[model samples]
Every structure is written in C-alpha cells, then in structure tokens.
Target chain A: TQLLEQSPQFLSIQEGENLTVYCNSSSVFSSLQWYRQEPGEGPVLLVTVVTGGEVKKLKRLTFQFGDARKDSSLHITAAQTGDTGLYLCAQTFYGGSQGNLIFGKGTKLSVKP
Target chain B: EAGVAQSPRYKIIEKRQSVAFWCNPISGHATLYWYQQILGQGPKLLIQFQNNGVVDDSQLPKDRFSAERLKGVDSTLKIQPAKLEDSAVYLCASRQWTSGGPGGNEQFFGPGTRLTVL
Candidate 1:
C-alpha cells in the first residue's frame, strides 16, 4: 500500500508564529494537493502542485512539491487563529488504470491567540 | 455557485445498526466522490463516480458499505451492520470534469455527515 507519512502530528503555536508541515512518501505522484479542514466540515483545497520542484503561494501559505514528486511541504507565515485546523496532503495514485487520491494522516495545527 | 450539500449533519446509532447519508453535488459537476474521515486522519476515498458511472471503489468495504450516484448528480452512501470503527465523518465532494481526465480540477466539499456508532 502506498502511504503518505505526515510529520508533527500535532502542533500548537502562538499567533504570528511560523510553522511548516511535511508529507513524505516512497512512491511518486503525478500531482499533489494540500487541504485545510475545520471541525465538522470537509476539507477545502488550498493549492495543487503538478510539476516537480513547483511552488505555489496562497496569501500567507506557501506550498512546495518535492523534486522527486515523492514529497511535499506546507509553510505558514505569521499564522493566525483562523489558521488552526487539520492540514492534509493528497496525491493521485494510478493503480491499474484507476486514478484515486491517497491522503496523508494529516497534521493538526492550533494557532492560539 | 452553491457548494456541495449533505443531509443529517450528525447521527448516532448502536453497533450493528444501519444508516444512510445523502449528498447533492454542485450543479453541472460531472465527477462525485465519497470519503470517510476518521478522527485525526485525512479523508479516505471510498468511491468515485463519473457522471453516473463507477470510476473507482477499491477501498470501499463491499460487505457493509455501499454507495450509488444515480442520475449523475446526487448520491447516497449506506452502512449496514455498522461497526464501532465505522464512526467517522462521511464527506461528499464533486468536481467539474474537463477534457483532461481527473487531474487539475479543484473539488468542492460539503459539510460532512458525522456518524457515531457505539
């Protein structure tokens, strides 16, 4: 089974602090996506990186795809209380002509005021 | 445009009970997905449908879990004889399919249905 391992399972940081979450895997993916989910709600797409070594910025968040396409990272600068949530990384796995996403366990981040 | 919609925000039932959840994707979205998200974990895809056709259901537990997307727009997921491990959030998502298969599309998610199996 292809698994995405996420680092720092739980994070509690003060507001304005910077934090980074990592997702690593042995298998390569065609594309990687990052999502943030609040309690009682489903995940919302933050950004998607398709090419190796690609980087995308959305406001205060910066997402980077690994050069080998086997890993990805999400960095938050000056995080606010609103940024506290569960962050997940997912990628499409082509298993026998079937394309479905395999997701990481996720990192739970808490940005305290 | 409206986001995906799901009914019964929360449900609590004993083990071995049966339950079903409904979902309505955003209008015109040709691709729909059902996922199960256990606490402290990311959402896992249980099934995927492309305009009323099954695309993938490799991870779904066929014995107790079943889902269908009829008419290519709305869908339902049912869990019969639920186990304690079945307690989790059931999320429904949909995406607009373009000429290029399943890549490069942003999926919109609905507020999940939280099920608690005792």
Candidate 2:
C-alpha cells in the first residue's frame, strides 16, 4: 500500500501565527497534491508539485515537494481564521500504466481569531 | 463552469437498510470517482469510472456495495443491507482533462452525501 503519513494531527494557534504541516511516505510518487476542505464540503485543490524539489505558492500558502518525491510540506504564513480547515496530501502511485492517488489522514487546523 | 454535484446531502438509515446516492460530474468530464470518508479520516476511493467504463474498484466492498456511471455523465452508488460501519460521507469527484492526457489534473469535488446508520 502507498501510505502517506501526516504529522501534527491537530493544531490550534492564534491568528497571524505561522505553521507548517508535513506529509511523508516510504514509496516514491509521480505527483503530489495538496487540498483544503471545509466542513460539509469536498476538498479543494491548493497546488500540485510534480517535480522533486519543487515549490508552488498560492498567495499566503507555500507548498514543497521533497527531492525524492516521497514527501511534501505545506506552510501557511500569517494564518488567519479563513485558513483553518483540513489539509490533505495525496500522491499518485506509478505502477504499470495508469496511476491512482492515495490520501493521508489530514491535519486539522484551527486558527483562533 | 459548474462543479461536481451530489444528491441527498444527508441520509439517516437503520442497519441492514439499503440506500443509494447519486452524483453528477462536471459537464464534459470523462473521469468520475466515488470515495468514502469516515470521521477523522481521509476519503478512500470506492470506485472509478472513465466514460461509463470501470477503471478501478479494488477498494470497493463488493459484497454490499456497487456503483455505476451510466452514459458517462451521472453515476449512482448503492449499499445493500448496510452496516453501521458504512456510515460516512460519500464524495464524488471529476478529473480535469486537457491536451496533455490530464497531467496535473486536479479533481473537482462535490459537497458530498453524509450517510448515518443507526
């Protein structure tokens, strides 16, 4: 199984605090994606980093993929209440032909306003 | 320009009862996926379809669960004689398509159907 392990299952911080979440796995992946999901809604894509040692930014959020393509990280600078939600990382596994994504148990973040 | 859509935003049923959920992917999307999400857990893929054809169902519980994407647009997922463990949110997502065979394709998800079994 291509399992992705996420760190800091739950985080609570005051407004304007910076935070970083990590996702790691033993197996290599072809691509990695980060998603943010709110209550009662489905996940929305934040970014996808396909290359090793790649970085993508979405406004105040920054995402990075490991050099081995086996890990990724999400960082939020000056996180506001609007930035609170579940952060998920999914990786596309490469096998024979088509690939499938395996998601990790998300990091639940709560930013106190 | 619409996102994925799902019906029965919430359903409460007793154990052993049967229920079905419907999903309509974004118009013109060829790939559709069904996923199950339990509390405090990430969504797990139950089945995947590409234009009315089954692409992957390795994680689906075949004995009591089934799904289909007929005509390559809307789809249905059914659970017969459901177990309490089956309670969760069922999410539908559509894969993005482009000229490069969907590289960097990000899935668009629906609000999801929340099923509660008593």
Candidate 3:
C-alpha cells in the first residue's frame, strides 16, 4: 500500500504568520497534487508538481516537490484568514490503466485575524 | 461552465436505514467520481465512472453500497442498512478525459452531501 504521511494534523496561527506543511511517502510517485478544502465544500486543486526538486508559486502560496519524489511541501507566506482550510496532498497515477488518485489524511490550518 | 452538482446537501437517518444521493456531472466531462470523506480525513474514492461505464469501484462496499451513472450524465449512490461508520460527507467530482488520459486534468468537485447516521 502506498501511504502518504502528513505532519502537523492541525495548525492555528495568527494573521501574517507563515507556515509550512509537509507530505511524505514511502513510495515514489510520478506526480503529486495539492488541494485545499473549506468548510461544507469539497477540495479544490491548488497545483500539481511532477518534476523532482521543482518549485511552484501561486501568489503567497509556494509548493515544492522533493528530489526523490517521495515528499512534497506547501508553504504559505503571510497567512490570512482566507488561507485557512484543510490542505491535502495526493499522488496521481499517470499513464496507468486506472489512473486513480491516493490522498493523504490532510493538514487542517486555521489562520486567525 | 457549470461545476458538478450534488443533491440533498444534508441528510440524517438512523442506523440500518437506506439513503440515496444524486450527482450531475459538468457538460463534456467524461469521467465522474464519488468519494467518502470522514471527519478530519481526506476524501476516499468510492467509485469511478467513465461515460456511464464503471471504471473502478474496488473500495466500495458492494453488499450495502451501490452506485450507477445512467445515460452517462447523471449518477446516483445508494447505501442500504447504513452503519454509524457510514456517517461522512459524500462528494461528487467530474473530469474531462483528454488524449493524455486521467493525468494532468483537474477534477472539479461539488459541495458534497453530509450524511449523519444516528
């Protein structure tokens, strides 16, 4: 079984504080995706990282994929209340017959103003 | 374009009761997915349909949980004799299948139906 372990299951921080969440796996993955889900809603895709040691940024959010393809991280700079949500990391199967996604338990973040 | 739509935003029932949820995928999306999310956990895939055909349903509890996507547009999931563990949010998602297959495409999600089994 391919398992994705996420650290700091819950986080609460004041506005303007920065935080970083991690997703680690024992198995290597071809592609990994980050998603954020708010209360009463399903998760929404934030980004997908496929290359080793790759870094991508979206506004104040930054995503990094480990060189070994066994870990990924999400960093939020100057967090705001709007940034509060459950952050999930998922391994996406590419070019496979099923091509399904396996997700981590997720990290719940709360940014208080 | 409209996103995936799910009905019955919330439902509460006693254990052993039966319930059904509906979903309408976005237009032109060939793949539809059903997921169950427990509290403090990420969503887990229950079933996958590719244009009205079942692509995968390995994790589904076939004895009590059943789902169908008729006409390749709308879908329904039914659970019989629900247990307390069945309490969770049911989410519907849709994705457009491209030549590259399921890779790289974003799966749009619905607001989800919260089910409570008392």
Candidate 4:
C-alpha cells in the first residue's frame, strides 16, 4: 500500500524560469525513477537514483533522492518551452523481483514562451 | 534498434462496446508490459509478461479486460463491454532481461493508444 504524493499538481511558468517538483512517500524505496511525458506520448525516462542523497543532472534538469529514501525531487534550473510536460516519479521497492513500478499522480508543467 | 510499437493510435467507442489493441515489442526483448494512464495521472501497470508467460496482473480488471502475449513477441489487450471510466491512454513497453534484474533495465515505450469511451 505504498503511495507517492506529488505536489503542485499543475504549474505554469514563463520560459527560462526555475521550478522544483516534489514526490514524497511514507515508505522507503530501493530506487526512484523520473519520467517526462508529453501530450499524446508515453513517458520517457529521465533519470534513476538508487543511492540515498544521490543527485543526477540531465542538462538543465536535476534530480535528487532523499536520504531516507522516502522522498525525491526534480528541479529545473531554467525551463524552456520544450520542457513542458507531465513529470512522474516511480518507485521500486526492495524485494520486488518483477520490477513493477508504482507511480505518483504526476506534476503537469507548462512553460510559456 | 526499433522501439516498441502499438497500433490504433486512437480509438473511440461507446460504453458497452468491445475493443482491442495490439502491441509489438522490440526485437529480442523478453519482457513486455501494458499500462493505463488516465488523464492527469501517471501510468498504471495493467499487466506484465515474461516471454509469453504472465508474471503479474494483479491490478488488471480481469472481469471485463483481457490480454495475451503470443509467441513471446506480439501482444494484444481487449476490453469487453467497456465502461466510461475505462477511457485512458494504453501504453506498451518492452525491456531486455539482464543480469541486474528487470528493475535495473530501461523500458522502451510506444506512442500509446488513446481510448475514448463515450
């Protein structure tokens, strides 16, 4: 019964602005994955954080996993119009052999040019 | 390499009608997955197959929904007497089994089939 709660369900920001979206859970996870899904397309993986307090950057985007493994965050330093999409966080709990993912509701972002 | 492929990019049906969608996984991939993504929500795993064998389908609504992976390659999912809440984008994904387990592998996704139940 692990659940992922994401904050700021919808965000509208101007181009070049910065923002951070959060994913929190009450249960500890073995790993966390970030994905970006555009309209009419399936989600594409952005990054995976396996270590506590680990941070990974993909260009202008930065992803961090909480030290307790109960939370994660995605920060965009300077978002562009192309970065507008729904951001999702998925968790892989320990002892899950099939690697099934339980995803958060997601944060929809719109970047105005 | 080619990615996963799904057919009928869009389908519109009235409630109580039947519909089916097809998916072809990436060549040599041993794992395939089907997911349902409601609007404003993340994708939910509907079923998972490991080389044509069902691995997990706990969340699938078996009463009116069915899926099959044939020959460990192509797959199909169907809904009979669909409900209005069934409207969502169905996505197909595939992954090659590796030593680190399925969780460590990356999944390649298809464009998804948008189902609209009116």
**Candidate maximizing lDDT:** 3
lDDT of 3 by residue, B37-66 (tens): 999888899999999899889899999999
Prediction 2 global C-alpha lDDT: 0.89
Tell me the deviation in Å of residue A47 in model 4: 0.4
lDDT of 4 at A49: 89
Order of models, best TM-score first: 3, 4, 2, 1
Interface RMSD of each: 2.9, 3.1, 2.4, 2.5
Ranking by DockQ: 3, 4, 1, 2
Q: Rate the local accuracy (lDDT) of all candidates.
A: 0.89, 0.89, 0.91, 0.90
Could you tell me which 10 consecutive residues in candidate 1 chain A have the lowest summed lDDT?
A92-101
Q: Which stretches of candidate 1 lie over 4 Å from their true place?
A: A94-99, B98-103
List, residue by residue over A25-79, the lDDT tens digit for candidate 2: 9988678888999999999988878889999899999999999988999999999
Clashing pairs in 1: none
Task: Assess candidate 1 and give its TM-score to the true structure.
Answer: 0.94
What is model 3's native contact fraction?
A: 0.55
- A-chain TM-score per prediction? 0.94, 0.94, 0.96, 0.96
Could you give candidate 2's per-residue lDDT for residues B1-118 as a string of tens digits? 8889999999999999999999999998888889999999998988888789998899999999999887989999999989999999999999854223224567889999999999
Residues A1-113, model 3: lDDT tens digits: 59999988999999999999999999898789999999999899999898899999999999999999999999999999999999999888755325567889999999999
Report backbone clashes per prediction: 0, 0, 0, 0
Per-residue lDDT over B1-118 for candidate 4, one digit per residue giving the tens place of the 0 to 100 score: 8888999999999999999999999999998989999988888999989898998888899999999997999999999989999999999999886325323887778999999999
